[model samples]
Target: MSTEILEQEIALLRQENASLKQQIAASIAELNTTIAKLEQEISEHKQTEVVLKASQAELLAIFNAIQDVILILDFEGRYLKIAPSSAPSLYKPPVELLGKTMHEVLPAAFADYFLDGVHKVLKTRQIEKLEYSLPVGDREIWFEATVAPMSENTVVCVARDISDRQQIEAQLRHQTKDLEQTLQELKRTQAQMLQAEKMSSLGQLVAGVAHEINNPVNFIHGNLSHLEAHIQDLLHIIHLYPQQSLETEISDLDAEIDLEYIKDDLPKILSSMKVGTQRIRQIVLSLRNFSRMDEADFKAVDIHEGIDSTLMILQYRLKEKSERPAIQVVKNYGTLPLIECYPGQLNQVFMNILANAIDVLEQRIESKDAPLPTITISTSLVAEGWVKIAIADNGGGMPEDVQKKVFNPFFTTKPVGKGTGMGMSISYQIVTEKHRGKLECCSIVGEGTEFVIEIPIQQ
Candidate 1:
């Protein structure tokens, strides 16, 4: 019985050992599969770690390359993280800034501004910008900050130095101011030149007027003496009519006085005196019109009337002289409506242009092969609600380069004392700025020169 029991127990123990081995082998296989899966997960985790490190390096490199100071701030304007930077706009070092609030490092005003900006970024969830100047030791450095929301209560601030740009804008403003002053001074100088030119023209006008008046006065004086003699002879005849031999005395007196001659000459003297008075009246009218002091402001006026007045004022220069023939003026006027303009200024423009034309024509008179000195003025309604007035001269034409700058300030082709060079420039300003018109010049080398003025008929 003992041997049988021991053998059965041994056999059962063997079978149990075999089943335990099978279970153990299955557990070992499961453990090996789990170990392989764990190893694979570990390898994947290591690769992710490398990729995360690379991303951090790239971000750090990007931050380092930028000149802006990158800072992380809380909603309360506390400096949480400050990127490593060498920017001079930073008021303090990164060590002193981290973990400290802006109120602790900056002035109350700057701290308030920063806190407000951060709150605004958080509220709007959008980027906000602020510009400030910091006193980094002695000098002030300007910075432009861009604050963007990073989280619910955190903001990222990127501040860039803008001192150089601010300085450049300030310099530009100063230069602009200087240029304005210079322009005002130039305008003042031009005004003085214009006044001087006006005085010179007035002098010439006075001389011409005096000469014209003197001739008429001398003729009137001589004619008055002849009229007085004739009247005395007639009076003598009338007084002798009371005498007894009145018929014979009247007949003798009539023969001695040459009554028919007196009758013929009296009307002529009266007619000539009337003509002189009319001429003087015309001259006065022309002067009054040319000066146009009453018309200082804008008014509707006849263009031809102004042109004619200006021509009369400058008539002395156009007369035939000993050295040259008279410069002929040809007017090609078309049907034009009344133009609204400053009459006085327009006359001044006409005077300047005509004077210059006459002078040029006079100079060219010496050339044997030169064309007849002619100043042709043409007026017309060139377009709807606009008028054109062209003044041209068949004289020595100007070059293209000279014509380009003809309207520039202080540029003149005449001798130093002869011209102030501001005439055309001022005229251009008057036509363009005051009247809102255009003044242009066109010329050919050997042909002629023309100045065309186009102005709106209405204002």
Candidate 2:
């Protein structure tokens, strides 16, 4: 019985040991599976870490590449993170600016402005664009900032220095002003050349006409004296023959021919011819003075002579026409010194002013009983050794606005074909710019217009 019991116990023991070995083997397989799975998860985690590091490095690279003064701040204007920047206009360096409230690092006024901007961004939930200035050390620097919401409580500001752009704009403005001034000078010069050419041509024409008329006048004048002397001799001979000595045929011929009447009329005709010739000679001389063919250069000349000569040249226009009465000229001449000036140019100024005055008078549309069309010219040496010549017309005056722009180029109040707008403009330049003078216009509606020209008497 004891031997059977021992065998059964050994069998039971063997069964238990085999069962335990199988369980242990299962446990080892499960442990190996768990270890393999854990190893795969570790590898995946390492790959994710690598990807995160690459993303972080890329973000940092982009932030630095933008090269703006970037700031991350909370709504209270406290700096949260400051990006490294290469800009030179920062109020404070990145190292010092980080972790600082705006009030602690900036002026109180500017700090308040910045905090308001941040609040505005949060309330509107939109990007804010603004400009500001900061004093670095000695100079103020301009900055442009772009602020955008970064989180519920924070904002990001990207600022750039715009001082260089502003400087370029200012330079452009200065250059434009210089160009405009140069253009005006060029225009004035061109006007002077054109007017000078016209005056020269006119002078040549007048000189030619004067020379032509003078030749015939001289021939006729010289012959009149000789012809008169010969006729007187003949008349003396006839009178000496006596009526008593006349034959019947000669007396009858005298009765038929009226010889006595012819004798009486002949002397009076000769006397009138002499007077006419003298008037012709005087007109020719005036013409010569006016053309000034030999007086083109600057020299001391009688200002009154210039004015009178110009008036003489314009006499035809001043004469009475069938349509209107003659325009009267009243001259109040004051004693003046011989003014040193370009005589021809001064004459041209006179011509322009007088011509304009005549035009105004001729174009009078007033009632027939209106004041007689008169131009009053006054000359005087005002207090500074200056010659003042005022030409005024009692014709229709210009409006205040027209008077203001009267001296501007291409401004005219006449019909296109009758007037070249450059006349008054050139006259102004001749007086003011060339001769260092002042030309002023005074006028009142329905009253009269006067142009006052003041110039130094000496060069």
Candidate 3:
């Protein structure tokens, strides 16, 4: 019995030993699982840290690469932080401005401007933008700033320098102004050229017409004296013949035809024809003198003869028209020596002035019931071998403003299409530039106007 009991005890001990071994294995397995999980968690944590570090580096690089100045300010305008990019733009080091108020670090005007933007952004919770210029050293620096609320009491400011842009804009403005002035000058030159061409063509036409008419008028005038004498001699021979010398039939025919009336009227008719031919001849001569096509170069000319020719050419206009009364011309001539000048151009100047005077006088007649229009012309020899010609009108004169621009090309007081606006301008050029003379106008609004022309006696 003792042996059997001992065997059972041994069996129980073996079973217990097996159970202990199993439990040991299970505990080892569980410890291995827990260790693996902890290792995995540690590995993940390390990877996350690396990613965070890289993100931080990238953010720093972006911040440093920014060109604009970045600043953080509190509600009271105190600088909270400044980006590294602002180092070049700041008045001092970023470290020095980090905790200081804008008023302490910047000028008063700049501080106030920045503070106002900050306050506005904080109150409105909206972005604020402004442009300002500051004189830095010897140069002016322009900046455009944008402020936005970063928090309830903090604002972010981004300012960019705009000096180069401002300079470019100013340069563009100056170029535009220069271009405009050049364009205006080109237009003026074009107008002057066109006027010159027109005058040249007109001169040629006048010269041709005068040449064609002169021959016919001279021939007719030369023949009229001989024709008149022949008619008188024939009439005297008839009167000397006796009535009884004729046959009876001839005597009856002469009595029937009123021979006495024909004898008296034929001589008078011939004399009238002679006078008309003389008048026509004078007019043709005046036309030739006025044209002066043969005398283009500078030559000694009678100024009074030129004036008379111009007057003769314009005589028809001076006569009484149905719309207005006749224009009265009072010529105050002075004894003067001959002058050397361009006769054709000088005549053109005279024509322009006289025609303009006539136009003004006619306008006055149409607008007002005033006295008869009168043009007074006076000539005198001034000192220094100069001649002065004063042509005045008793009509409404121009204002000061009009007188100032009267010689400018394409400037006129007449209605469009009625005046080419080039007459006075060309006249001015002829008197001043072509002849090396002076032309001036003196006018009073209601007292009429006078134009004074001064020219040297010799070229």
Task: Give per-residue CA lDDT, model 3, range 353-416, as digits (tens).
Answer: 8878888988874556576789999999997899999999988999999999888877889886
Instruction: Estimate TM-scores for all models.
Output: 0.79, 0.53, 0.52
- Could you tell me which residue pairs clash in candidate 2? none
State the lDDT at 459 in candidate 1: 92
lDDT of 1 by residue, 63-174 (tens): 7777789899997788888875565667998888888898999999989987888898899899999999999878999999999999898988888989999999999999
Looking at model 3, the pairs that clash are: none
Each prediction's whole-model lDDT (CA):
0.88, 0.81, 0.81
User: What is the per-residue lDDT of model 2 for residues 11-45, given as tens digits with 9 covering 90 to 100?
Assistant: 99999999999999999999999999999999999
- Native-vs-model 3 lDDT? 0.81
- Cα lDDT of candidate 2 equals 0.81
Model 1 alpha-carbon miss at residue 182, Å: 2.6
All candidates in order of lDDT, best leading: 1, 3, 2
- Model 2 poorest ten-residue lDDT run: 200-209
Among these predictions, the greatest TM-score belongs to: 1
